[model samples]
Target: MARFSEKKIVAGSLITLGVLFSIIAAFTDCSAGGADNYAHYNIARWAFHYPNLFLDHWGKPLFTILIAPFTQIGFFGARLFNILAGLTTAWICYLLASGWKLSKAWLAPVFVIFVPIYFILMFSGMTEILFSLVLMLAIFLFFYDRFVLSAVVISFIFLARSEGAIFLPIFLTALLFKRKYVAVPFLLTGFLLFSLIGQLYYYHNFWWLITKLPYVGGIGANYGRGSWYHFLEKAPDYIGILIFLFLILGMFVWLKKWFSSGLKLRSEIFTRLLIVAGCFWGYLAAHSYIWWVGEMSLGLTRVMAGVTPVAGLIALVGWSEMDKTIKSKIGKAIFLGLTILFIVLPGVLKYKSEFKADTREVVMDEVVKWLRESRNFDHRFVAHDPYFAFSSKVDAWDSRRIQYGFADFTKPELNIADSTLLIWDAHFSQNEGHIPQKEILDNPKFELVAYFEPKVPLKVLGGHDYCVLVFRKMENLNVDNNQLMIKLKDEQLKGNLVYSEFFDFEHAEPGKVPDQFVVQESDTFSNKCYVLGKDSEFSPSVLLTDSQLKISNEVSVGVEFDFLAEDQLGNNEVLMVFSVEKEDKPYFYQGQDVLAVDSAKWNHARYHFYMPEEVKKDTKVKLYIWDIQKKNLKIDNFRVQAYSK
Candidate 1:
């Protein structure tokens, strides 16, 4: 009776600690601008209104489907579900430890929750915690000889994560070794039921398993490919160095015990320990090829979160063995203190750092709130982050995936008659290498609506100078009158407009070069004031000479032009070069970086060149437009000016 009471006290204490951690997670602002979290949230939210939500191949969708109903209570409810999942996982860990007859079973929950990555992800509305919970439950049921129940749980494991199919082999192997033939039929039945559920959800046959192979294969092949030693390199951050060392020690001790007993001892505890070790190593091996495990910015620790409990259990085993070997109480105490300090301190520090307010989430929430209040409820947006789309409850297309075909600055296919809103942030641009700043600012079709700069700078996950900008595509906007006038007025105010050309090309033929400009390398044409790149194989280069302009050494000269382009199948670039004639040779003054422009939209390019003191009286200034890889570019409205400091 006393032992029962002591066990109850320990269980209650662990539950209380779990509840405390959950509360901390609920209130903390640890959410990042991770695309996976947003994708999960959006998919879950979409499942509420849409039928056959699991037809897509992007995500597994079980966690999303489960959380769909509670999402009405807002994102907090989804996070609360994760908290429950995490606590349940810890409970499973405790059960496993108790079954192993560990002296300190209560420490299992502490070790699992205190791992920084697991704790942080538990609050972020990701699928890792839920996956961990289900996987652990399946293992626990298997150990208890509840074969049918274990098989059912194992089926759900695959739904949690695509890679979870690895567990199927592990479970089948275990059952085969134990000679549990009755469980084999139950496992097959569970798999069939799971397939039926997939069919109903996807509105298709059981072809998803086969169809998803290519998609899954493409992920590692295209995006996040890594070497075999990827997980080993990331082990220190996910599980601390000391904990990892202890895990190794635990494996070694288990191996020694098995060999010393002549490999015939089939104790349940030893078999269970072997299974746990297999799971840890198997998960690592399975995910080593994934790019996320190697990529620190994507949170390699989060990717390895499923095996966190196993790591804790291994460390516990090692600690127990060390305690027994150290006969002196003082030596044991010293060893235990060192282990705690080395393992727990790092995780605690990491948790504190991660718990601080995430700048990206805060800024995104602000943007969403503003969009909801300011714009129509039915406004459609083309955005980089789906989180904003989910929060704003608006129809959105991912800019990276969908091409916005702007026919005179309107996407007729999308029924974008009035306007289409565009939302972008620094994180997406930096990570994905898609910079649409020039495209948005230069095009008259897009008007700046709002800009948000984070009050406190983001310090983690490669975040710096974080900012969000919103733009609305203008419909029926006349480029010749409004946009050109604005540019002219702004340039005149800056006191830099020395030479200006609208290039109406009214008198020039379609295939002939304009009278004012000279073709340097490639062919160009003037069609009704629009300079067009005619060469298909090479980019056109055109030169405009200004012999009347004075080349002053002290003043900086600015050359600006507007261009329109057609979307192509490959890469495109625009370059502007400024040169001056010195000693009968053209000397390079300055040039702009290769500027990328959007299709069917007018873009502005500008470059500044400082005149040198060595210029003679015969120096002739020239401006060259180099359409490097770009073809079918319409160039017009050229301006040049000098500004004094």
Candidate 2:
């Protein structure tokens, strides 16, 4: 039999390099993932004091408990905790690879360390690395013939990420098929412990464990989903292109062999497929399904970091296949050289920004710093993305010191005390907080206190301009924004509509495209504009490219359209997108399901947006609709008007 252990030098070097990179990233890079990352750190930091926070479904219970001690020092401590977890994951990955007696198995650690998003996330306070570590370790334990321990560890997958429950079947099948009946009972170990703890918290009144599940809402449009192949499309961005390609190839080669070979449950290759590759692809497929169905999954590629070890393992398998397929020693050397060259250098470079400090967080840091130095501000602040809470050393759960309203602060149930300071950011506030800037601005009770624009104009993902704002609530003073808006509209309309046009379709022909609305001129002759609109990739769209608006000053634009869908809309939505882009990158972008109707009826929808400062005179702006389900529809009275801001 081939030796299972890797060379001591190879092991030490891989371990050392992984540790060094994680340490450097943890301290040096200020940005990681979004609010969830900071929120996880906060939960871990304070879970001991607020014992319920340990069971806080959003922050995985086991993750909180394990990481709590480390987080006492600061978020850096939690980051260090992840570093350990990540290193442990790499070690287990290396062990599994070498134990399988794969050639050049030292590449496993290298693969895990350099996976772009995994590299960044492993050093951050996010739960993905830890979650990945636990799953990977369970298999490692099983590999060592610790069947009961493996079952117990696999059960704890839920306490890391809720979706991890999906992997429970893999172990269940393995244990049952292997006739390890005792190990099968151990699968409930994690749930039972958490249940007891939750029972204590609930005073034994009800099943707090079930009630506390964050994703209990079966399937609804919480965060609208995307394509079924979303993960497949985005894997390269998460893992580097070399790993992504290798991962694909690994799945093909591994699955091909697994199916072709004997259908024995106790085979060695079955173990490899079920644990390593199974965890990776199974996760990818599950996430893809949720995202496709418009379930709770937001379709973030960062979630892939949780399965980084398995992904790296699969990629290594692919590398081994490449080795086996090429019999010539010289040819194998060249291929290995190419793999090393490509993986070491860069093929997926778009994700490089993820390694650096996110400009959004950097800009928010300035805002928080200013708030700290400028005046004596109350810790009782209202904000989305409890970033302020973390930075100010305020306990998020201590409502006495802080009025922290997460997600739905706009709702009346979430009462905000008078004279509260609010930090309304563009990113978290718009997406997770579900509050628009206009809502805050229009409210008479709140006054815009400060606005900090970055020194250099910058835009983050989703075209959110990097601008942090500060608002203060004053109950004593008030002004009628409704009256102000009416007056402003009157004043603007009295002047002139910068560019007002309406497509009534009365003069349009079925065979002819609308005037000045064709997206591609090459296909205009062949495409049909059914009455007045054509919406294929090669056809016409509602493009506001007229020079009339170009010469005008900054203005607020409102687009109202009448729509009638031929088919009922299910989870899909009639997405109307209003965007302003420069050089193909959007400067301002907003998509609304203006007509989310089940029946075929004429629905009048109004969507409004202000022209961002990023929009230049020569910049291209587009206003379009995306029928996600491709429901053929009739649109009429499509009108757009812009008035000076």
- Candidate with top TM-score is 2
User: How many clashing pairs in candidate 1?
Assistant: 3
Candidate 1 lDDT over 18-132, as tens digits, reads: 6786687667755532656766666666665664554344556567767777665766677777777887888888888898787567667767876767767777778888888
With candidate 2 superimposed using the best TM-score fit, by how many Å does residue 537's alpha carbon deviate from the native?
Answer: 22
Candidate 2 lDDT trough over 10 residues, lowest sum? 520-529
Q: Residue 114 of model 1: what lDDT?
A: 66
List TM-scores for all candidates, in order: 0.66, 0.71
Residue-by-residue lDDT tens digits, candidate 2, 397-436: 7877765544455651246666677787777666556666
Q: Determine the C-alpha RMSD for candidate 1 after optimal superposition of all C-alphas.
A: 12.8
